[model samples]
Target: MKQFGAKIQSFFNSRLGFFVLAIALFWGKTYWAYQTKFNLGVAGSMQDFLLALNPIPTTLLLFGIALYMNGRKSYITMLIIDAITTTWLFANILYYREFSDFLTFTLIKGSGAVSNNLSKGILGILNPTDFLVFADVILLILLLSFKVIRMDIRPIKKRFAIGVSLLAALLFGANLSMAYSDRSGLLTRTFDNNYIVKYLGLNAYTVVDGVKTAKNSAVKANAKASDINSVLSYLNKNRTTPSVTYSGVAKGKNVFVIHLESLQQFIIDFKWDGQEVTPNLNKLYHDQNTLSFDNFYNQVGQGKTADAEMMLENSLFGLPEGSAMVTDGTSNTFQAVPAILDEQGYTTAAFHGDVPSFWNRDNTYKSWGYDYYFSKEYFSSGKNYDVGYGLKDKIFLKDSAKYIEQLPQPFYAKLITVTNHYPYTLDKANTSIKQTDTGDDTVDGYVQTAKYLDQAIGELMTWLKTSGLDKNSMLVLYGDHYGISGNHKKAVAKLLGEKTFNDFDNAQFQKVPFMIHMPGLKGGINHTYGGEIDVMPTLLNLLGVKNTGTVQFGSDLLAPNRNQTVAFRNGDFVTPTYTKVGSRYYMTQTGKEIEKLTAAQKEAVNQATNRVTTELSLSDKVITGDLLRFYKPSWFKPVDKKDYSYKLSNGLKQLKEAQEKKKTSVLMKNDGKSLADEYKTDAPELKTSEAESASSSESAAADESSSSSSRSSSSSAAK
Candidate 1:
């Protein structure tokens, strides 16, 4: 036993052995980061295994050069290198917690506000076990301090050090080549950021991301205003005017936009266990006052839900990569819907049940000219109020009634729901619907949460009607993006009773719900092929608000001569006849590729492809170069962000002042009282959770007691 101990001690004391130990430490730290920080699935798959092993060659090549230095210089160099690498990994872990994405040079360049915005709670990202990453350095320091090991003065041979580095380099090259061969077009194709990190290591992903950012920056710097001529010409020639019959139908009405997160069109009337999955949405879909679209596709880019927002508000495409709101949105100029409505005597505010800074929205909303922005801080943050993403859908809608009732008349407001987000999970106490046992947990959970969202929407509509706001309000509801990705296709296939899921099925799944409910209007399902980009023009036209001088990329969907070709950020397109994904063209009706095409058919496909490519390139340049700053519309003025505040404490006072000044607020017309008193709900959370139920009971008792006191005072005065 003593002999074995001595041999282990000797191995640790040796210079070559310590070098090997350092390599292991570096590699181990990287693997730890992969397991903890990223959500890249199992380690059993060959692709994932290769990614786990990727940190080795880079670490070896980096540390191999340190061997050329003699004695303490060599030892200190390795320690410094290890510190830098460890710091990089630690920083990425913190960033991934908020963004769920790796860092880019663009993000790093604008990281000035990151530190100040970071709350101490972000440190929760670090686990106690993470400290083991520094164990090697601590162990080395202790042994050297006790004089248990002495440094070797001899230098490693230069030829040996160089040879080690060269071998490592060759291995890294082969690793990259194998990754590319395994995932076809791995380095070039438009894919999810997660795929890049899963196929290649985070280090390699960062390097690739850096290269792409640089390339985009270079393209923007070299672009000119004249490059927009073709884009402007195309838009002007194809511009769609509002239909004479529908124009001014909902003029001067308050607008309420309900953003349904991750909802798809299929859920509109989908049945589960012989019951309607979304009964509330089913009623609205069939209602005579609602104009719903069955063929509305979500043309979002990498920003997903935020991309949908960008298109709906500004008729602008999101960036080809990261969210425009996070990347270039803060600095770019936009002729957004809120600002346009502001010119027409409308008060605009946005409500979200999450922190303002999560997606850099606190900064971007100001640029969009919102008069007030209410985030999660304004809502109830008490027990049982929040779910995974933010506030529970029921609690969020209930709490928002307080502020929504106070907004000045003719307000343009938006409510963003989050309970139906990805990896959907609902507390049993909150959920009343029966869950499916579909083997796939996500798809099963998706149905329950989606049903919950429908219930919340029903409660909101009831509030609107009882509060008397429904008579003069236009309600717009839209699904932000797809709920399930291709990863869950098999489960979705079983749910839909399909034989097999294919690319066509995936493409069809991209359809998102878009509905507009206007009181006393002729409404029915419209089968036009439109997207989120067309929303702005359609709403503005219906409200009798003209955006005559704006540079919008989409035509009004309600127009008599609307353009129906929808272009995706990836250069794919969908028209009434054909769907183009990459180089292949398929019939939209049949989803089959055409082996042969007539001359007219080929010409039509070529024209659509050219239009899509040109539009995407122009949009990219507009965002990256901040070119909109140069194009000032004659009727538009740049928003002064300094005028708005998101602070919740002063909310009541702000609402009162606006009402007193205008004398046009609906709350004032209803005798200086809030409309939330009329809101009725039987949500399970409100009934089952003690905290929520107590709060609701207390509010009701207070209102009743106040009414009783008022009657007694009036009777005594009469006597």
Candidate 2:
């Protein structure tokens, strides 16, 4: 037994054994994180096997520095390397749990400001088993402290260490080349970070992000306002006028814009296993009070939902690659919807269940002229209440009633629902729908959650009717973007009963639901070809608002003679006749390729292509150059961010102050009560008794103070 113990100790104390041990520990933790923490998907291919082992070369190259050092210095180097790698792995695990994305240099640079706010939530993302990430390091420390392993003074030959590093570097090159071969043009194209992490590894993703960040920083720094002038001029010349009939139709009505997360147009009236996918949405669509667009497409870029937001607000395109919300949101100026509405005697508020800083929205919303921003701080903090994104759809809509009612009348409010977001996870208890098992977990999960979102929306609509908000409010509902990407189209194709998915099918998949409902209005399905950028102008026309001098790229869909060439951020376009992606133009009705086009068809395609490119470039120029700051419209007023703060209870504090000043708060209108009381739900997160208790306590305190003051005055008189 003593001999066995001595042999084990001797092996661990040796140079080669220590080196191998270090590599094993680092790789073990990284691979564990990759499997357990991240959503890297099923490892069913040779490429997947390679990706699982991708961290090895990088780890070896980094930790090999220990071999060049001697004695305690070498040991110290190993410790430092282990600590850094462990910390990096742990941080990414937490970040991935929240965002389903790897950490970029841009995100890390902005981390400090948001870290304190997100720390508690960060702790929640971790599990008791996650301690294994540090278990190896802790074991080493204990072993050294107890003399279980001894350090030798001898150093490894410098030449051998250098050779090993060179070998690792060569292996990395081979790994990268193989990955590129497997997923052709993997690094060159602009794609989601998931592809990068799935092909290479987390370490490769960080390096790629750093390079992209540096390039973007240079591009931003060198951009000039002069570069935007030509683009601006083109838009000014091409901008469409408002429809004569619809103008002023919904004037002075409250606007309730509900952002349906990851909803596609196909699911509007879709059914699965004898259940409607979105029954409430279908009802809203068929209602005489609503105007639904059958061909409305989502033209979002890399920002996805955030891109849709920027388009709806500014009538401008998102960046062609990354998120404009993060890359340019803080610095660029916007002639957004909220700011425009603010000029028309409207109060603006945005309610999102996710963290305000998720897309740098906390600061961007301030500049966008939102009067109040309710985010994660305002939602239930329980783990069960949150699914993939933030609060569950039920809790988010119900709890928002408390803050929603407080907004002044004729307000512009946006409710972003995250229940149908990617990975579409719903607690079994909250779900009444079942998956149809289409051989894709994502697809199966998608149907169930989409049904859940529909139910939640139905609940909200019921409350709106019961509370009488429906009559005076114009509800604008739109899907942010596609729920599934092109990668998963095969499974979706099966679900849709299509034999094969093609480029023409891809175009159809981009369609998202867009509807506007005003209680007394005549409504029907409009067959206008439009995109998210067109939404702002269409809504503005209905509200009797004008974007006369602003360089909006989108034309109003309501206009009888509106331009129908809806441009995507990637230079694709869809018109009434055709869908143009790159050099290929497909017939809209038949989905057939035009092998030999007529002169007019060719001319139209060329014109549409140019228009799409020009629009995207100009939008990029506006964002990258911060040009809107140079070209402020006459009616637009710069937002005063001092009026709002998202610090703990700051929104509630502002409401209280407004009520005290008799500044026409809904709470005061209701005689010092919360509208949440009207919303009758048994959500465990809602503590109505506690809220009532606090209200009762306030009245009790007021009476006690009056008695004490009277008693004190009587005593003074006696004296």
RMSD of each: 9.1, 9.3
Candidate 2 residues lying further than 4 Å off, grouped into runs, are 1-212, 272-275, 343-345, 423-428, 433-446, 484-502, 581-583, 638-644, 658-662, 681-719
For model 1, how does the per-residue alpha-carbon lDDT over 1-719 read when each residue is reduced to its tens digit?
99999987777676677788888877777888787766654444777767776887778877876888888888788778877777766776776654445666755554333453335355755667666767767776666778687666677788888888898888888877777777666665433455566766776777787787776667667767776665566677767777778888889999999999999999999988888989999899889999999999888877887788888998888878778876555445677899888888899999888766555576678778888778867777666777766788888898889888778889999999999997889888767677776689888888889998999999999888888889999999999989888788788888778887776677778899999998897899999998888899889888987756566787788787566788888888898899887777789999888778789989998888887787777677677776766676678877765455555544556777888898777677888777776777776565557676788899999999999999999999999
lDDT of 1 at 591: 87
TM-score of each: 0.71, 0.72
Clashes of 2: 0
Worst 10 residues of 1 by lDDT: 111-120
TM-score of 1: 0.71
Residue-level lDDT of model 2, residues 1-719, one tens digit each, is 99998887788888767777878987887787777787665345866677667988888888888888878888878878888878877877776555445666654564342354347466667778777899888887787788777777787889988988998899899888888777665666534466677777877877887886777667766866576678667977887878888898999999999999999999988888888888999999999989999999999987888899999998888887767776666545677899889889887899988766666677678668887888877776654677756788888999898887777677899999998988887777767778866789888888878888888888888888777788888999999999988888788888888898887788888999999999888799999899999988889989999768777888888888787888877787788899886778899888998888899998988888888877887788887777776675678887654445665466788756655654454566777676666775545444544576789999899999999999999999999
- Candidate with maximal lDDT: 2
* True lDDT of residue 148, candidate 1: 80
- The alpha-carbon deviation from the true structure for residue 97 of candidate 1, after best TM-score superposition, in angstroms, is 17
Off by over 4 Å in 1: 1-223, 649-656, 688-719
The collision pairs in model 1 are none
